[model samples]
Target: MTQDLFHPHRHESHPKIISRLKRANGHLAAVARMIEEGKPCLEVAQQLQAVESAVRNAKQALIHDHMDHCLEEGSLSQQRAELKAISRYL
Candidate 1:
């Protein structure tokens, strides 16, 4: 499969991040199943919040690695583009 730029390669570079993400994936799948089964709204909302937090944490880790490695050494134009793309996260 062709990995896009946003693909989470950092997780492979650091297994801890991958493990965190794997746990989050299980949580996400469970939440989805709960929603499908008409679980309580409040419980679903809580699960959604947990998923959002997990995604943000994963994204932050990836961004930190990208900035420290790719963007830092890239040319000015590349850095500018990366900065613009990264801003979308915020």
Candidate 2:
């Protein structure tokens, strides 16, 4: 079987990532409502920007935590491969 990266504990940043994603989801729903209600374009765009930023930040945190937990502890080839794989998202 393949190894499990997470055992008894989860990555420390997971909680923050989940929180960010939840906020982003809420903002996205609000933006949809705002659209249907004829809100100003500028206000809608600003809220979209906030949602995008939250998602981006959460993704960054997850990647950083992965690097810390995997890259820092894996074998040389594994670390290089992992880093190369994750680099595409950046």
Candidate 3:
């Protein structure tokens, strides 16, 4: 990936991406607390699911932003290669 592809838009979206990751971090901390507090299995599972979803959403947001702003000006081959590399997460 070209650094220029990301540098131009990084300032615009970096903060939002960081905020999302922080939210996910908080959710994970809550999950840990719930487990320590001996919460019911069902409740704990629900919170874990929420944490997982939050993390997944954050990852997807980052990937989407990268694709939109960074990949838009790239060659088709580069874009395809990047998409292929990220496809495993999908």
Best by TM-score: 2
Ranking by lDDT: 2, 3, 1
Judged by lDDT, which candidate is best? 2
Better of 1 and 3 by TM-score: 3
Per-residue lDDT of candidate 1, residues 64-87 (tens digit): 766666666567987888878886
Cα error, residue 28 of model 1, in Å, equals 1.0
Give the per-residue lDDT of model 2 (tens digit) for 1-80: 12666754477778888988998999899999999999999999999999998899888888888877767765888888
Task: State which candidate, 1 or 2, has the greater lDDT.
Answer: 2
Ten-residue region with minimum lDDT total, candidate 1: 8-17
Clash pairs (backbone) in predicted model 1: none
RMSD of 1: 4.5
For every model shown, what is its TM-score relative to the native structure?
0.71, 0.85, 0.79
Once model 3 is optimally superposed onto the true structure by TM-score, how far is the C-alpha of residue 19 displaced, in angstroms? 1.1
Assess each prediction's global lDDT (C-alpha) against the native: 0.79, 0.84, 0.80
